[model samples]
Target: MSVPPENLHPRSRLVHDALRAAGILGEIVVLPDAASTAALAAAALGIEVGAIANSLVFWSDDEPLLVMTSGAHRVDTAALAERLGRGRISRASVEQVREATGQAIGGVAPTGHPAPIVTVVDEDLAAFDQIWAAGGTPHTVFPLTYDELVRLTGGTVAKVD
Candidate 1:
């Protein structure tokens, strides 16, 4: 049996609420071990790594940019910067990540932030029928479709490779 959403951790509960408000009913799954990385999450769920949606936080022009990239691929910052017409794209610091996302580095979800953040969804993620993303914590995750992800984050879909 699954635990009630109210019984989840505060962070995860917020995420659950956010997802629920967005019409997403996927139950958040908690792993015995920390699934901080996409590879670990995929292995724990017995899914292909490519199907994991890695939520990477980046900073460009002092703004938070969330990139939902495929786990199997790395975001080419330089190329992505050019494509997005941003000046240099750099990884956000741990403090910055937490401030912008209200979650740790290894477990930042697409939504559930203090404010609406600018997001970009990788085109490669659309290849998978289902994509698993962090659920506001290192040990929790939830599944959703590409369209759902795009709609949830209101992210612009682009090639991130």
Candidate 2:
């Protein structure tokens, strides 16, 4: 059974409100189980794993970088840093993830953070007409198109892997 937006976790409600404010028509779908991983989310949604937009937070010179990568690919931090003209990119600590996104690692949404994060949307995700993204909680997700995601997060489109 899917949980309605009004019944969502507080964090998920924040994401729902953000989506509405942005004029996105999609509603958050709460999974029966926590879909923390892309594979898990794909299986739950009955969609291709590539359609899952994994929200990853990285540390670039002490700044937080949010990379929305396709589930079908693995992000190469070194290559990404070189492509972005950055020195190094490392996975953010759990604390940093929470502080930066105001959500847990496995449930970070592209928007609805305490502040705007520097985000990069994977170019490969544009191949999909619709994509699923985390909804501020492990058990919640939402759908949107690639263009909508880029606009929502104000992210740069790049080949993340």
Candidate 3:
């Protein structure tokens, strides 16, 4: 059985409050684990892999770039670096991740960063009717339509593969 929506983790509660303040209406749901992988999350939620919105933070030189990618495609780091006109692209360290996004590794949400971040939404994600994104916790997720995500994050739609 799943926990009630009102009984959310603190991080997820923060996410919910932030989303609402941003004028976004979505429902947050929590699971049992950090769910570091989209496959694991999809399996647990019984949703298609394509519906999982994997929030990935990449270190683009000295800046942090957030990519909301679909579980179906792998991000090409080198290509993305070239596309972004960055010298190099690398995964962010745990500290860097926390500092940049104001959230821990597995719980990072697309919004609610202490500062603004350049965001990119994978074009592949548009194929899904609804996508599940991290709710500031590894085990928490929220439902969003593809267009809503693009609008909410002010994200550029790109072919992230």
Candidate 4:
């Protein structure tokens, strides 16, 4: 169900507020069931898995790298690193993810992080007119256009897989 900003989970509220501050009007929606995975989120939303923008955090050169990748594919760290001209990028540990994003592992959003993260938007996500992303929790999600996601995160568009 759609949740107004005041009624959102604390973490989700952060996302809601962030979205509002960024001039986004889409309200956060809570799923009846937790959708910790992209496949599950797609099933619940009745959308193609490719339309789900998976918020992934990767550790690169001792910094947090936020990758908004398409749910249908996996991130190729080696290629990504080479493309980004960075050192090896590895999946951040749960604790690291939490520390970097101030949110949990299962439902991290691209925005509302403790600090601005170097973000990458998967070019594949642009194929969808609308994309869904986690709203700071596994049971929450929000919708926006591909351009909005890029603007929200100030993410560099690139091929992630």
lDDT: the better of candidates 2 and 3 = 2
How well does model 1 score by local distance difference test? 0.94
lDDT of 2: 0.93
Clashes of each: 0, 0, 0, 0
Model 2, 45-71: lDDT tens per residue?
A: 999999999999999977999999999
Q: What are the Cα lDDT values of the candidates? A: 0.94, 0.93, 0.83, 0.94
Task: Name the regions of candidate 4 deviating beyond 4 angstroms.
Answer: none
The prediction achieving the highest TM-score against the true structure is 4
Candidate order, TM-score descending: 4, 1, 2, 3
lDDT of 3 at 117: 84
Give me the overall lDDT of model 3. 0.83
> Which scores higher on lDDT, 3 or 4?
4
Output the TM-score of candidate 4. 0.98
Question: Which lDDT tens digits does candidate 4 get at residues 1-161?
Answer: 99778899899999998999999988899999999899999999999999999999999999999999999989999999999999999999999999999888779988888789999999999999999999999999999999999999999999999
lDDT of 3 at 36: 71
Estimate, for each residue in 88-150, the C-alpha lDDT of model 1 and write its tens digit.
Answer: 999999999999999998999998999999999999999999999999999899999999999
